[model samples]
Target: MSIWEEHPLARRFWKEGRADFPIYDMHGHMGSLNTIHLARAEADQMVAHMRRIGVKHLVFSHHHALFEPSFRNVRAWEICRNHPDILRMYVAINPHYPDHIREDLALFDSWKPFAVGLKLLPDYHQVPLNDRRYEYALRFAAERKLPVLSHTWGGSSCNGYPQLAEVIHKYPGLIFFIAHALFGDWEGAERLVRESAGNVYLELTALPGERGLLERLTASVGSERLLYGTDLPWFDEYQVVGGVLSADITEQDMRNIFYANVERLLGRDW
Candidate 1:
């Protein structure tokens, strides 16, 4: 049996620790490692996995190689549309691909789901954050009121954190979701949140295994600012989810961290 089925969390639609919780996995990629593209069945398998893990909804993003502007966001959109209640999407626009941004945004506007937000990966795409190329994307997102979720962590030796920090300062109203939440500078994330007056979003995907981190963060920032994500195939499973909820947080806080918070932020009941 799958872990979600085997665990007690599966028996209850909502845990006491997390009263009437509705899970919305806010981050993940849909493609496989061997194939350059995401096959339809493979994408379906991802949804099956989410279901098995009790994830009611997910905001699926595209892989970095597929983050082209000229092409349609078909893969991401298909996954979301296929499982309207189980998956949602965000366009991962490559800032360097200036021509594709408008088209991609138009597609997004047309499809229109919960649309957790935009996905940006400066390290994977080899572009430093705060480059002028992203200004258009940033400005566009700001205009649309779309949030930007960046895949930033320890591997980067560049100015990603600082440049992204600069972007935060540049656009006071732009909601930037910092994925991996500064693996290299966790404290820096805390400082940025304090300074930004809570305009910044610190996504927690890498710390589920470490129980203490969530508790520390919840106390520091108030669980309302944190969003639940699994980063998909790379880190999808109940062990992580359980560890995250099982951390030193009340079931109520766990429900907020895993469900209600994202629901409210993304403006969706499902």
Candidate 2:
């Protein structure tokens, strides 16, 4: 009965009584899961409830394309083009691909999504972040001022976080947001936050209100480096934002977490 196994991702909304809030589900995948599975149908129905609950947006990555550059970029474009209201896509670079950034940036130029960014899921892709193969993609993104969301978990072990760290340190100019807020490893994420300072950020998706996770991070690195994300369908909105809203933070902080940070990162007012 784990979240991932039993759809542990939906526990907060389904079980924690948070079905009413509008959820941004900053992190979710667009697929037939909702069409093929009854449980997923329930999840799709939950989207209307998300609107009621204050969930305004969903920043999604094509889970199937995370490992394939061409397919990932193409599918991401189609999805965003079709569902501009609720879904925005962040393309994944198969770093090893010949065209890399150009292949996707061309799509962005034509598609003009409200928010265009990148998602790197090194664990699933079996790529190492520090492998030096992603330099071109990272450099190109930095030059364009595009935000790159890297998958990091205290649990991801080696995958690509090392490369992610290297990319951040090397580019410094890139808007790098680490998803999963250290992936349930508060200490490691905190350390990265302290080290990155303002150069990098962390997304509060699965981490939610991990005890003193936010407080300690705020104290050390300032709350500005934190981005609010729900990992929708993966984590519950009520559990993610409720305790966070009640925490010892400011209205400005709340605003930043809810929308501003991501808006600023994506260069959009929303």
Candidate 3:
């Protein structure tokens, strides 16, 4: 066998000719990312991708929320409800609509167990991470003990990781997931996540085939603070999961990244 093929973790992962652990995709989208969109028939592609990849459950936000801030989350709730066995919803928030924010938070509170967390697309919406409008959502998340996943790039725009740093420090009790940090600025993401409180985490999605990005993230934050994500429908599911499986880390770390860490965040097994 080749050296990589002989590795113990590889053997276990591929012993049955597939991944050994149940995959819980922490990042996924249920709809199109556009002003105009297709119907549910097109969006079911996300469901098909999950089933094909053996993804047991996925946490997703509908792209409809990016534009239609008022009713998109309720639509997302319906999508998750329809696929209750395999899906959890992230209540999408747009800080631009302060009028709708309260009702949105109420909707999330009503969803309770079905609402896994909150999703903020500051990069798409161009809202600042430190914007006062986000406080209500953050406070609701803190009260509910739910995680808040936000779009984070590298530079110092309102949506950048630097701006998120301010929010992270302000609410140490809230768990923050830095989505797409891998594809943004790996070094800056690593530094920010490493320096912040343990409540901050980085989700591995939309990542390049860099030699040591995963290893460096594991080293900086350890496995418990890292999550696996596919950004499904936007990217191939197997490709994203395989990136973590191929990382040069121990089996325990692999287990954590693949399932355990997100399970801990969700407070239950999938």
Which candidate number has the best TM-score? 3
> TM-scores of all models?
0.84, 0.76, 0.89
lDDT of each: 0.70, 0.63, 0.75
Compared with the true structure, what per-residue lDDT tens digits does model 3 show for residues 1-270? 842478665665455434656778888776665643534324466777677657778888877675676566777777777777788878888988876778778777667556889998887788788888888999888777788888877774876766877888888888888887735577777777777778888887776245788788788778887888877667777577567767777788978887888777665653
Q: Which regions of candidate 2 are displaced past 4 Å?
A: 1-25, 32-38, 41-49, 67-71, 96-102, 155-162, 267-270
Which residue ranges in model 3 land beyond 4 Å of their true spot?
8-17, 35-43
Q: Residue 117, candidate 2: how far off, in angstroms? A: 0.5
- Ranking the candidates on lDDT from highest down gives 3, 1, 2
Greater lDDT among 1 and 3 belongs to 3
lDDT of 2 by residue, 1-270 (tens): 543225322444456544333334556654434224434323355465456556667776765566444465676667565556766767776656647556676666565554467777666556676656677667767888777787777766544345556667788788788887766666667666666737688777766566766776666666777887865555555677765655566656656676666666554533
lDDT of 3 at 251: 80
lDDT, candidate 3, residue 43?
48
Which digits, one per residue and each the tens of the lDDT, describe model 1 over residues 1-270? Answer: 654344455335324323244577777776655544444335678777667656777776766434544455765776667678777777786767767766677666677764656878787677787788778778877777687888777546433567767888998878878887776576777776777846787788887778488888888877877888887756755756766746767666777777777767666564
| Highest lDDT against the true fold, candidate | 3
In order of listing, the candidates' clash counts read 1, 11, 0
